[model samples]
Target: MSKKEKFEELLKRLQEISEQLESEDLGLDKAVKLYEEGIKLSKLCHQKLEAAELKINELKSDVTAK
Candidate 1:
């Protein structure tokens, strides 16, 4: 899958988790599990953004050197 697709999928999952957490009927065990999963997903998204930013910077530098 493309980077864009992966990012979109992660974002969708995060939103779903957010909605699930907001529900008043959720059990503690399930809520805790969702929170943990959300945290991991958040970290993954952050890492992906950082990597993309670094790549963009490198490309810009290369262009400026030409």
Candidate 2:
């Protein structure tokens, strides 16, 4: 999958994780696993945001150069 597609999928996973975390009856082990997944998702989201920022900067430069 492309970086963009992966990023979108990660976002959906993050939302699922969030919903799972919100449930009051989650077991400790499952909660820990979900927390770890959430951390991974957060990192991926940050990386995607940075990549998008870089792309926007590149586009701005290209527009200015034209």
Candidate 3:
């Protein structure tokens, strides 16, 4: 998948995790596992955003250099 698609999928999963974590029906073990997964996904999303920001900055610099 493209970075954007991957990011979107991760974000959607994170939202689902959030909803699951909010539920009283969730067992403690499962909740902890979901929270861990969510943290990893959150880091990935941040990395993707940082990479995109860097790319945009590079493009802007190139345009100004011409």
Best by TM-score: 1
Q: Candidate 1: give the clashing pairs.
A: none
Of 1 and 2, which scores higher on lDDT? 1
Higher-scoring candidate on TM-score, 2 or 3: 3
Give the residue spans of candidate 2 off by over 4 A.
1-5, 53-66
> Could you give candidate 1's per-residue lDDT for residues 1-66 as a string of tens digits?
326558889999999999999999999999999999999999989888777743333333556666
lDDT of 2 by residue, 1-66 (tens): 336457778889999999999899999999999999899889978877776643333333556666
lDDT computed for candidate 1: 0.86
* Per-model root-mean-square deviation over C-alphas: 6.7, 6.4, 6.5
lDDT score for candidate 2 against the true structure: 0.82
Clashes of 2: 0
The best-first sequence of candidates by TM-score reads: 1, 3, 2
